[model samples]
Target: MAAALELFGARDPDDISIDDVAAAAGASRALVYHYFSGKRELYVAALRSAAAGLERRPPPAGGAGSLDALAGALARYFDFAEEHAAGFTALLRGGGAGRCGEVGKIVEGVRGELFASLTRRLPVREPGALLRVTLGSWIAIVESAALDWLEHRDVERRALERLLVDQMVATLTAAARHDPEASHVLHNLKNDR
Candidate 1:
């Protein structure tokens, strides 16, 4: 799996083959087959392993249910991308068709976790609708920013990450302030001031 990840980082996922991985791992092709049904499965496994590693890392401390938490999550995501560029690309591309079913599940699990986290921080009148829009928009922005960073390697990754995090925090904070449930919370803060 590590060999596969290294190869994936060096080339496109479709260009990688079981033979390549097996040779790199010094394992028999049959052994690779025994573990993975096909190349797609192996690729998904590599990506899943990487994603699980990222998931296990704790979110930043302080402001557990606030925009700070969201920023921390985004920072973690960017850090993962920066460190494991190939693994991140494989994980993102594995969502396409003709891939392992488990890949979809992994993507769904991450999306669900992110949505749940954002939803918990949100004070929405219609939680479901608000969550859908907020999470979708947030993901779109982050994905776009990451892709942009990938295309321009010379760009400052940390600055780009901070810019995205700032945008997300500002957008979510504004939305929450207007939300009926959050309005009271905002009102209390203003009163306390």
Candidate 2:
């Protein structure tokens, strides 16, 4: 499972064979087959393993207004993306893991967990519709930025991390202008800061 998880995250799932996993694990192909019926099953299991790693990460701890905590969270996210570059691409591209039903669910579960993680860091106990939308949009932005960063590799990681943090603050500031719920949260966040 560890071998498959590493390979799947670094290379295209289609390119990986049972033999490759066996070789990487120093086990026989027969042993691999003993655990998994086929390559797809193994791939799904590897993806599930990958998802669990991300899901298990503790939410960043600090005050709601702590931009430093947000930056720390972004740093960890980028570390994961960097470690799983090709796998992260495949998971988000809708051409690899997204093609499989189980794979899609795994990916969505990761996104949902990330969303919940962000919400927990905010001042709001329960977010209103507009704040919810704002948070959702911010997640999309972060994902898109990570994808672009992986493909281009032009922006420094620290710069990109700071940029994402600023983007979230700007988004919340904008949302607060028109939303009482957002306004309240923003006010609290600023006070804590």
Candidate 3:
């Protein structure tokens, strides 16, 4: 599964055959079939496994008290992407629209965890909407950056990661400050100023 994910970031769940995965894993194709019914099921299982691994590897502690947790989480996210490029790519790129079905649910599970982590550190009252916008934008940027890094290995990963994080923080902070729920607070601060 890891090998297959490494090979194709995220193609049609049905497109990836048991034989393909077996070839990648150096296992008998029969064994692969014996374990999994088809590509969709296997892909879902792979996603679950990946999510589990990521959850087990906790992000660094200590950033929670300082609002620096966002930076730390972004750093950790980039590090994870760099180290497990294939798996991370697969997780980010896979599945279809709506997240209603099995595969979609798994994808949503992964995305939900990321959104929760990001919003937990922020003061946003409408966390759901804010998290959606923030995560969607972040994903787009990271995906583009990842592809660029793939093509041009000369670019520094740390530099790109820091830039992404900085931009995300600025955007989220501004949005939080402007949120209607915080309007009173902002108005008070403005008057004080």
TM-scores of the candidates are: 0.76, 0.87, 0.71
Spell out the clash pairs found in candidate 3: none
Query: What lDDT does each candidate get?
Result: 0.68, 0.80, 0.62
- 1 against 3, candidate with superior TM-score: 1
Provide the clashing-pair count of each candidate structure: 0, 0, 0
What RMSD, rounded to one decimal, does every model reach? 3.8, 2.2, 5.3
User: Per-residue alpha-carbon lDDT of model 3 for 22-129, expressed as tens digits?
Assistant: 998999989888988866667767766776666656765654423345556666766676767666656665543224266556667766776666555444544456
Q: Can you list the residue pairs that collide in candidate 2?
A: none
Superior by lDDT: candidate 1 or candidate 2: 2
- How does candidate 2 fare on TM-score? 0.87
Query: Which sections of candidate 2 miss by over 4 Å?
Result: 94-98
Compare the candidates by TM-score and give the number of the best one: 2
Per-residue lDDT tens digits for candidate 1, residues 17-114, read 79999999999999999999988778778878877876776766645455456567778888877777767666666533264678778767766766
| Global local distance difference test of model 2 | 0.80
